[model samples]
Target: MRAITISEPGGPEALVWTEVPDPEPGPGEVIVEVRASGVNRADLLQRQGHYPPPPGAPAYPGLECSGVIRAIGPEVTGWQVGQEVCALLAGGGYAERVAVPAGQLLPVPAGVDLVEAAALPEVACTVWSNVVALGRLAKGETLLLHGGGSGIGTFAIQLGVALGATVVVTARAAKHDRLRELGAAHTIDYREQDFVEEVRRVTDGRGADLILDIVGAAYLPRNVAALATGGRLVVIGLQGGRKGELDLGALLAKRASVAATSLRSRPLAEKAEIVRGVREQVWPLVESGAIRPIVDRLVRMADAEDAHRLVETSDHLGKVLLVR
Candidate 1:
């Protein structure tokens, strides 16, 4: 087997593709022969030694992948060897083979290619869990999403639209047209405009019913200010640093709430529940052509460093894949 290992984490160059021992499935797990893996900001964080894999997870850095099952472990059932599936992982997607918990596997949606399926699991589960399950974004509500051109953001935009919510996003000006095509009702250039004001203006001063933010402390005050009465703000990443003062008075006045979450460190049962929800609710939208994979480009598995570079630069529109 071959996997990308960090040769002392620092930069993309630290991700070294090298031969490694083959992974064997443990109880309730399955071995997947990876066909492709999606590049994420987390991968870059891991490479820079800022984020480490969870306890007992593979040292390699990847959060999602698409592959065929090679073997199933004890206590696992309903999935078989040779079945094509995409999986959400805590780590180790940047390898030719990975051992995955059975609960994390999702059948490839109808009409999606196996390689492209690699792009779905992480984004799907994240959006489904936060935007739908936690934020409770409903029809006629407005969602303001930061990093709209990102993998999770792109998926969130489409899913919000599919669920009948009005979607607004913040991204570079050049990406706005494509985002609008993906069902974003409005796009704000985060570089040049005040997203809080733009979101307010777009919603007739009502503010967003839900704001899905990746930027952390840097946007906290503005995010709270941009929320509608009784709105929810779900923060999934801390790209903008970690600490910030909260305005309890503002939150109390609007009856708004804020939650910060990460999928990688969650317990297995919770991840299974989220994956199940995604399969039942989100997969249908994908199969029906209401949502599709947003891949910026594909790189060979051996050149994962290049993929990481692309993701770090934020030059790509959606996911950057490392293919076998």
Candidate 2:
């Protein structure tokens, strides 16, 4: 097998695709012959030496992939070799073959092809867990999202719309129209417009009932101000600086809550739970055409360095996939 390995983390050039020993299944795990893998910002972070894989996880960078089951391990059931599946992986998606926990595997959603299915696991589980499960996004409420043109943002937009919430998104001016087409009730040009003000304006000054933010400390103060009474704010990414002071008085006045989560480092049992929730609640909507995986483009698996360069530019909308 061949995989991308970082001899010394630095730039996209560090992702070297070279021959490596094939992975074998362990207890409650399966070996997947990779067909496609999803590229994410985390992959870039890993390549730059900022993030490392969790203990016992593969050294490669991908967080999700679509593949065929080549072998099943002890204690695995309800799955078989040759099944087409997509998996939520701790690491190792950027490879020809990977060992995956059986619990993290999902059948390819109906109507989605193999390569595109690689786009689902990470974004779907993240959105479903934060927005629906934690934030308790109810019908008839307004949901505010940052990074609206991103892979997670696009998926969240469709999910929010399908769940009957009005969606408001923040992105650059060029991507606003496309986000609106994806069912965002409002779009803010974060480069020029104040998202806190825009969100309030679109929601008739009630503010958003739920906010999903990726810009960490940079947007913390304004995010609190943009919340409605009893609003929930879930922060899933820290693209901005990490530390910031919060106004506890403001939060108390609004009776709001704030939470932060990292999906990659979660325990396997917890990830399995998230994956189950996605399959049960999100997959039906996908199969029904209510939501779809939005892929920006596909690059050759051997050229992962090129994919990393593109992702860093933030020029593409939705996911960039690496295919065999």
Candidate 3:
């Protein structure tokens, strides 16, 4: 088997696709022959040595993939050797083969292409877990999603709309039309507009009922300002920086709450639960054509450096995939 290994943590150039030993499934795990994998910002951090794989996880960068099951381990049932599935992985999706916990596997949704199914697991679970589960965004509410052109942001926008929430997003000016087409009620250009003011204006000064943010420190104060009374803010990415000072007075006045979470570091059972929720709630949306994979482009697995570059540039909308 071959996997993208970090020769040294530094740049996209550090990701080296080289031969490695084939993975064998352990108890309750399955070995997947990777067809395609989603490229994420976490993959960039891992390539730069910032985010290491969890203990006992493969030393590769990908967080999700779609592939065929080649082997199944003991204690795993109801899955076959040749099943086509997409999996949520803690690591190792950037390989030709990966070992996945059976609980993390999901069947490819009925209406989605097998290769494009690679984009669903990570973003679906992230949005479903945070935006729906934690934030409790409901019908008639407003969801403000930062980095709207991103994989997670794009999915969140559609899901929010599908779930009957009015969706607002922050993205580059050039991406606004596409986002609006995807059901964003309003789009704020972070480079040209004050998102906090725009969000408040769009929501008739009540502000967003739920805010999903990726930029951490740089946007913390503004995120709080853009939240409606009793709003919930879920921060899943620290692209801006890690440290930020909270305005206790503002948060208290609004009765708003903030939570920061990461899927990669969570326990297997927790991830499985999230995956199950996505399979039941989100998969139906995909199958019904209400939500679909938003792939910016697909690069060959051997050209992973280019894929990493595309993600870092933030020029692409939705997911960039690495195909085997």
Q: Is candidate 1 or candidate 2 better by lDDT?
A: 1
- Against the unseen true structure, what C-alpha lDDT does each candidate score? 0.95, 0.95, 0.95
| Candidate 2 backbone overlaps, count | 0
Q: What TM-score would you give candidate 3 relative to the actual structure?
A: 0.99
Provide the clashing-pair count of each candidate structure: 0, 0, 0
Give me the runs in candidate 1 sitting further than 4 Å from their true place. Answer: none
Worst 10 residues of 2 by lDDT: 196-205
Tell me the TM-score of each prediction against the true structure.
0.99, 0.99, 0.99
Per lDDT, the best of the predicted structures is: 1
Query: What would the per-residue lDDT of candidate 3 be over residues 10-94, giving only the tens digit for each residue?
Result: 9899989999999999999999999999999999998888899999999988999999999999999989999999999999999
What is the lDDT, from 0 to 100, of the residue 249 in candidate 2?
100
Question: After superposition, which runs of candidate 3 have C-alpha atoms over 4 Å from their true positions?
Answer: none
